[model samples]
Each structure stands twice: as C-alpha cells, then as structure tokens.
Target: MTPEGKALLNIVILGLGFMVMFTAFGTCGNIEQTVIKSFNSTQFHGSGYTSMAIIYAVFSASNLIAPSVIAVIGPQLSLFFGGLVYSAYIAVFIHPYTWSFYTLSVLLGIAAAVLWTAQGNLLTINSKDSTIGRNSGIFWALMQFSLFFGNLYIYLAWHGKTHITDKDRQTVFITLTVISLVGSFLFFLIQKPDPEPAPSDASESLLPTDISDSSSVVASQGLGSQALDAFKKSIQLAMTKEMLLLSIPFAYSGVELTFYSGVYGTCLGAMSKFGGDAKGLIGLSGILIGVGEIIGGGVFGILDKCNRFGRNPVVFLGMITHFVAFYLIFLNVASDAPVAPEEGTQMQAYMQPSVLVALICSFLLGLGDSCFNTQLISIVGFLFREDSAPAFAVFKFVQSITAAVAFFYSNYLLLQWQLLIMVLMGFWGTVTFFVVEWTAMSTRKNSDYASI
Candidate 1:
C-alpha cells in the first residue's frame, strides 16, 4: 500500500479491532452469561436478566459521561484505556472477585462510551460520507458476528452433552481477559492523523490538536459537541422531514434490535449452542441473522428513493420484516409446548418456549440492526451537507444518551419485575411506530428543513 493507503488501511483495521473489543463486551463481559450458563443447569437458570440488566445498564450508564472524557483526551487514548479497562474487568471475574463486578460494570460502560465517541469522531473526519456509512455498516455487521464467536468458544469449552460444569466457567473469563489485554497492545497502534476544523455553520466543533498528556479533545470538556447531538442537528438541518418520515416505521426495528441483542445469549444458553434440536435451531438462527444483516446493510447503498418517497419507506420494509420475525418468536414462546427429540441425551433444557422466542427475536433484530444502522448514516448524509460533521456528531450524541438511558431502564425494570421489561419493550415499539409515521408525514408537509 502507498503511504496514504497504508494509513487508511491501518485506521480501518484499528476501527475494526476497536469494534471487535467493543462488541466482545456484550458476550464475554457478561459475567452473568458465563457463570450462569457454565455452572447452572441445562435450562440456563437465573441469568438475573434483571440483575444482569441492571449491571449492564450500570455499565451502559457511563455514556452520559464518557463523551466529555473523549473530547478532552481524544480517540486513541480512549481506545487504549478502554482496552485496559476491559482487561481489568475480565480479570476480576477470572479470579472470582464478586465485589469488583459492580465497579467493573460501571468502568466498562464509561470506557466503552469514551472509545465509541472518539472513534466515531475520527471516522467522521477521515472518510467520505458514503465511505463512512459503508464502513460503519460493515463494522457493525461484523461486530454482530463477534457474539457468535464468543458463544462458539465458550460452548466448546464447556462441551456439555447434558450439562456444563461451573469449573469451566473460569475458562470463559480467562479467554476474554487475555483477549482484552491483547487488544490493549493493539490499541497502541492508533494515532491521530491530524485535526480538521469545523465548518462555519458547524453546530459542533472538533477537538483542537493540543494533545495534552491526559488525552482528551476540546469537545470532551462539557462542551456537549458530542456525536449524538451532532447527529440530531444534522437530521434536523438536512432532512428533518425525510428522517421523521423514515423514523416513523424505523423506530420499531430499533427497539427490537436493542432488546434482542441484550438477550440473545441468554436464549442460546438455554437452547445449548453445541447440541440438540433447540441447539441446532439456535445456531441456525444466529447464522441466518448474520446473513440477513449483510443483505439489509447492502440495501442502504442501493436505495434510490431518498430523493422522492424519502428514506422512510426503506426503513418501513425493514421494520415489517422484523415484525414478522418477532411474531414468529412470540408464537414459539407462547406455545410452551415441548418438542421430543428422537436421540441423544435430551436434557430438560431443550424445546424451551422462551429460547424459541429469543431466537425469533434475534433474527429480526439482526435484520433491522444491519439495515437501520447503514440507513441511518446514509439518511444523515442525504439530509446534511458534505461538511456537516458537527451536526452528525450531535445526532450521535443524543442517540447515545437516549440509548444509554433506555438500556439502563430496561435492566432496572427487568430486575424489579421480570416480565415487565418485555411488556415495556413492546410498548416502546408501539410508541416508535407512531413517532415514525407522524414524523414522516409532518416533515413532508413543508420543505422547511430541506437545505441540503
């Protein structure tokens, strides 16, 4: 590769690695997952979905704070430290330190938040709009695959024909701990290429290049120029109409994706990733979802109706497809009727309705996740000018905060009242439906926000 090409290649690899570590947190970081699955019964008892959700939410809660740290310190350090934090968190579990679990949860949330903002900012400045969306799409899709890998690795290690022993749970923590440390070393390779100034109409400002020893950017100092805020503005400025229109149908899928990614592993453990009819179906579900995501993300690039029907319809189709998947899963869950296997050590865990529900949910969630992410970025690009970095950044910041709060709340509810979280998620989906439809129609009534 030429010097410039090499830099780009390295950056992309860094970004990809960053995603790998970031995503590894979802599966490998879940202490509840490793402990509950490995040590517990074949039925995958007591995930503490509520407790784990709270832990996960506590970890996610740091999004409220990490952007400030990132804008001040900058992206490279955020990633380096984030990796170290993950290493520490995993090691805590490896040694079976229960007290560190809560503290580690919060730290992981905060560290990941900082890393996400910094990397997002870096990508915004370094790449073309189309290229950015495409890269983001690919990275997001690939990141989804990481969970499968984590599952495969953990399942194989446990190797439970009938049941997994708790002793092997140590392997899960150790594997992740090592991976996190290795990621830290890789983090050193990340270096800021250069700083670029925000445009005249820029609602947000990029960090200045005065790399202090502490490693923060200008935006990190409570300036609130974080990506979510930028993203919101870009949507409001460029294609408020188009986005609201698209968002009407698109929001339901978003709710589904968030809810399912949060729960898929729990389902897999109960179904067994390595064996049985349920296990076979569980594995099949994951692969199919990954494949669906690829197809959905590709659609983001090819859609030509953004100029006319707005970007709403593409999202609409994506949501409808997701709805079908969810419906199928719900039926499976509701049935509660058991399936009898003709062979092998059929544990009491197989043919679980809840696991079936989650499988259906994961597939639909994956489809929407793969499609919506690329579509969202592309939609922002269509709505905003090429130089609208600040706007997009703000958009991302808001989305992050909202997502963070929602994640926490989901867990809190799960803990407080088990089935309530699902009801709430479904209700949230209902609300999203109206938001998308109303926003789309309302935005279409006038060309007011059509500057781009």
Candidate 2:
C-alpha cells in the first residue's frame, strides 16, 4: 500500500476503535446519573452528577502531566493502557458500589488524560497541513456512530420499563464492558507510522516535527523533570494571548458538552410526565443526538475538503443551534428537572413536556456541539501545528475544568439557570473566537505584504 493509503487506513482504524469504546462508555455515561440515582435514591441522590464532576476534575489536573507521560510511553501504549482503565471504570457499574464507583472515576480521569492526549498526538502525526480538517471530520463522524448504536441497544433493552432492574443493570453493563475491552484491544491493531526525516528548513515547514524526537528527548530525562517541563510548557502556552482568548470557547465547549452528553438525558429520565417511557425517551434522545452529530461531522468534513468552506459559518451555526436548543429545553422541560429525580418535576417554566420537543432539543444540542468541536479542533490544529501535544493538553485542561464546574452546578442549579449560563458562555466564546481568527488573518496578511 502507498503511504497515503496506509495513513488513511490507520485513521479509519483509530476512528473505529474509538467508536467501539465510546459506544459502551458513552451510553453508560448518558445514563450514569439516573443509574446511580437508582442504586439508593436517598444516599446516592446526586452521586451521578458528583461522579461525573470527579471524573472531569481529575481529568483536568491530569492533562498537565499527560503530555510527558505520552512522550515517555508513546501514543500506542498509552492508548492500550488508557482503554483498559476505561473498561475497568465500566466494570465497576456491573457490581455497583459508592467507594468503587468514585475510585474508578478518579482512575478513569487520569486514563482519559493520557488517552485523549495520545489521540491528538497520533492524529497530528498522521495528518499533513491540508488533511487535518478532513481527517478530523472523518474521525469525529465515525466516533459519533457509537452514540447511535449504543443508544439503540438501550432503547431495545429497557424501552418499556418504568425503572431499570438489577438484572437489567447487570446484563447491560456487562455487555458494555465487553464492548469497551474489544475497542481498547483494537488500538493494538493500528500500525505505527514510520518516523519522518528531519525537516531541512524548519522556518518554512507547515507540518509538525515528528514526535519521535520528543520521545527520545523525554527518554533522556528523569520522569519527574519530564513531567515538570511538560506542565511548564502547557502553562506557558495557555497563558499566551491567543490561547487565553481561545480558552473562552474551549471552556464553553466543556459546559455545553456536559449538558448534552449527561445532563440532558438525566433531565428526560427525571421528569414524571414521561414516567414509564422516560428510559425509552432517554435512549431515543441519544439516538437523535448521535444522528445530528453524524450529519454535522459528515457534512462539515465533506465541505472542508472542498476548499471553499469556511470555519466561521460553522461556528455561527453552532451558536444559533445551541441557542435554539437551550430555549426549547427551557420551554419543554421543567426548570428543576436536573437537580434530582424526586425534587425535579415540581415546576415547568413554560410549555408542558412533549416527547417530540425533547427529542428535537437533543438533536439540536448534538448538532451544535459537533460544530463547536470540529472548528475548535481545526483551529487548534492550525495555530499550534508544531506543538500539538501540549496544545491539545491545554485545550483539554480548560475544557475539563469547565465541565467539572458545570457538573458541580448541575446538582444545585435549576434547569433555567443552567441554560442561561450556557447562553452567556456561548455568546462570549463565539465573540472571542472571532477575535483570535481576525488576529491570525491580520498577521498572515502582514507577513505576506512584508515579503512582497
């Protein structure tokens, strides 16, 4: 096979691997709060929210050190070990316990840190300057399929049930654990790309330098010093003017991600109006969300390859779509629905809950999220081409911190307030993103003029 064919094949493999893993993990995550609530309503009241909060919190801290760890271990091994840790976290659900649940959440967070950073590194290594957007689109589109299939399983398994039974829980989680393991092992199947020859002219190169050099450099350092240096570089990059401005949207992505992935479905399950079919609706909502994401990723990916498509339009699409979804959620779902199941159904701020409106909201939220993320990935890939690992780490760090904060507040805040916050962040994030884009464009134009 040609090297280009091999690269394309590897990108597909990586996407498929993630698709399988997240099918299990993402399905489980969508229902996590509700399932945890089922464990013992009195004691585990908001433990689902709390567990998610913990995962992101640890994930946030681990990003600082994850790049160095990836440098030491290499992206492939990091992926394998990370997948194992994710599977372990899913297994904890099979025989649910508070201590084990929180403990595994912590481990999963650290694993997530390494897993995602390795993914970014690998993706960057495999892509050329022109192909980054196309590759990212393909990867994202494939991964989003997990949501559709996983939720289809849920919709089939628990469709008519008022509540999930112990037998039901055991059966579902066990299957999910197996799926996650299979996905993890698939990472082993990915053939590592041969290291690139050194660039003769660093000043003119558009692609990143090979990660092989960084790996050798880290290999020579003590582990502690490597970690400290990685952390320092990440902090420095994050403090730069462009990254600082970019962090606003990055943080907003985190907030919106939590809402669509976990909180939205939980709200659906909590409302009394849905009753016996709430679980079914949760599954359905996930299916629609996945559908929207697939459409967005596939569409944007294709358009991006066409050379005429611009990033700003996608950003605006996401902003408008999210605003619409948030407003619909505000109207159709109860304000208190996200707080906890028992106390959630007392009030609806506007229209009564309809299954149709709920599903629509889910679809829009998913589509909007895809827009924000694909653009962010493209932006980061463009701006930080030479420093992919730490750049992605800082991006994840800011994103996870905001996700943690959103989860923390999801416990205490009403649905209305949460949507309001999303609105504010969405607006601010969009504006700041434009600022950075304009600045980059201006700099590029100036450089071109100077050369002339």
Candidate 3:
C-alpha cells in the first residue's frame, strides 16, 4: 500500500482497537462508582470519591513522565505496553480489595498517560494539516462507540432489575476483562510509522512531526539525559502564552467529563425510584451521551473539512450547549421531584418530565464536549506541529490535575453548587479559547504576508 494509504489504514486500525478498549473500560466508568458506592455504604460511606481523587492525582503526576516513556519505547510500543497495563487494571476488578484497587489505580494512571501521549504523537505525525481536525473527530467518534455498546450490555444485564447482585457484578467484570485482553492484542496489529528527522528540521516536513523523534537522536547519548531534555522542553512549551490560555479550556473539559461520567450517574442512582436499577438507568444515560458525541463529532468534522464555519463557531456552539445543560441540571436540583418505580411507575419515571430534562442535558453535554475536545486536539497539533508531544503532555497534565481536584471536592459539594461552578468555568473556557485562537490566526496571517 502507498504510504498515505498505510497511514490512513493504521489510524483506522488503532481507532478500532481503542474502540474495543474503551467499550470494555466504559462499562467500568459508571459501574466502578456503583461498586464503590455499595462497598462504601457497608464499609466507608464516601470512599468512592476519595478513590477517584487518588486515581486522577496519580494520573496527573504520570503525565510528567509520559513523553519520556513514549520517546524511549516509540509510539506503537508505548500503546502496546499501555494496553497491557490497562488490561491488568481490568483484571483487578475480579478481586477488588482496597490495596489492589489503589495499586491498580496508580498503574492505570501511568497506562492512561502513556496511551494518550502515544495517541497524540501518532495522530499528529500521520495526519496532514488539512485533515487533522477531521481525523481527530473521526477518532473520537469511533472511540465513543464504546459508551454505546458498553451501556447496551449493562441495560441487558440488569434486565429491569433495580439493583445489581454480586453475581451480576462478577459476570460483568469477567466479561470486560476478556474484552480488554482482546483490545491489547489488537494493538500489535498497528504498524509503526517511519521516524522523521529531529526537531531542528521539523519545519521542512509537510506533515506535523512528533516531538519524540528528537528524543530518538538524544537517546544515543543516554536515557537519563534524554528524559531530562524531554522534561525541560515540556516545561518550556507549557509556559507559552498560547499553551497557558489553552490550558483553561482543556482543564474545564476534564471537569465536565468527570461530572457527566461520574457525578451524573451517581445522581441518577440516588433517585429512590431508580436506586434499585441505577446500573440500567446510568447505562441508558451513557447511550444518550454516546449518541450525542457521535452526531456532534461527525457533523463538525464535515464542516471542518469544508472550512465552512471554522473552529470558533463550533466551539462557541459547544459552550452555549453546555451552558443550557448546566442550567437545566440546576433547575432539576431545585425542583427536588421524586422518581416513581419501573413497572407501574417505570414508564412514568422514564417519562418523568425531569428525567427527560436530564437526558437532554446529558446529550447536550456530550455534544459540547465533543466540540471542545476535538478542536483542542486539532488546534494543538496545528500550532505546535513538531512540538506536539510536549504540547499534548502538558495538555493532559493540566486536564488531569483539574479533574483530580474536581473529583476530590465532588463529595463535599452539593449538586447545585457543582452545576454552578461548571457554568462559570464554561464561560471562562469559551472566552479563553476565543482569545487564543484569535491570536494564533492573526500571527499566521502576518507570517503569510511577510513571506509573500
């Protein structure tokens, strides 16, 4: 196959592998909270939130080392190793003791950092400037399919049961473990891209270059030296005005995701009527979130390819959607309505005006999230180009840190307060994004004219 064809094919294969992994892990997103909630009620009532905080804190720290690790192993091997680590985390669900849970959380944090850093490197290096936005959108859309399938499985497994039994939890965990292993194997199928010249000559390349490529040259001197250099470069990159501005929105995205995946599901589970069948209800919510993301990403990708509305419009739309969703959620909290049961109360509960409101809110949140996340990836790849490894690392670092803090405080805050904070952050993120993009665009125009 031609190099271009091979690149496209590799992306598709990698995306499919990611889809499988996400599907397996996506089940854990809500279920983990349910498991923790159950365990906590018996043991320590709010340990679940503390666990989440610890996991994300470790994840934030791991981002500091991810670029160096990816540099040593190369993106493909980084992905393979990361996938193995993720599979290990899934295996722990079988015998989830406190120590095992915390230990695996640290491992999962490292795995996530390595996996995402490799992904950013691979995608940026392989894609052309003209297609990066679309590529990111497509990749995200495919990965989110996991949300849909994972939730579907949950819905079927629960089968209208209000509560999940120990047997049911075991069945789900075992199934997810097998699926995660399959995903790990699929990583072996991805063919690595050829290495490019070091960062000094990166401007000569037509495509975006991997910052890790520079580490390859530096590694010949020594591993420790290579790591130090990568660390310094990442710090330098993070200090740039553009990167600093962009970090706000990136951090907000993390907080938003935490709310949707963790807090929203927990809130639904708290409803007396759905409390028994929380797993199923949360699964249904996941399905809606997935559907919204698919629609948002797919539509925006086409528009991006055609250069119809540009990045800012879509981002603005996303911010607006999030604002509306947060408002709706706030209203729901204020109303404090009761949820009726599933059979006689099932349809009424399903059709409960507030439930419908929340579902719409979830869908909009997903849509807005897609818009912000895809564009963030695209913009960073475009602006940083050759420095993408450090740029992405710093991006993930800021996001993880913010998410960890949000999760830590989530237990203490009221739902109304949480929504209020989100609304304010959304507004701030939007303004920051606009400022950054405007500056970047202006600089590009000036550069073009100067060259002419």
How far is 99's C-alpha from truth in model 2 (Å)? 1.0
- Each candidate: RMSD: 7.3, 3.5, 4.5
lDDT of each: 0.48, 0.82, 0.73
lDDT of 1 by residue, 394-423 (tens): 344444443444444543342113224334
Per-residue accuracy of model 2 over 72-151 as CA lDDT, tens digit each: 67778888899999999999888777788899989989999999887887777677666777778888889999999999
TM-score of every prediction relative to native:
0.67, 0.92, 0.88
Model 2 weakest lDDT span, ten residues long:
203-212
What would you estimate as the lDDT of candidate 2?
Answer: 0.82
Candidate 1 lDDT score relative to the true structure:
0.48
Q: How many residue pairs clash per model?
A: 40, 0, 6
lDDT-better candidate, 2 vs 3: 2
Q: lDDT winner between 1 and 3, please give it.
A: 3
- Candidate 3 residue-wise lDDT, 287-383, digit = tens: 8888888887777763454354357887898999988988777765322221112221222222333667767887988899888888888888888
Return the clash pairs for model 2, or none: none
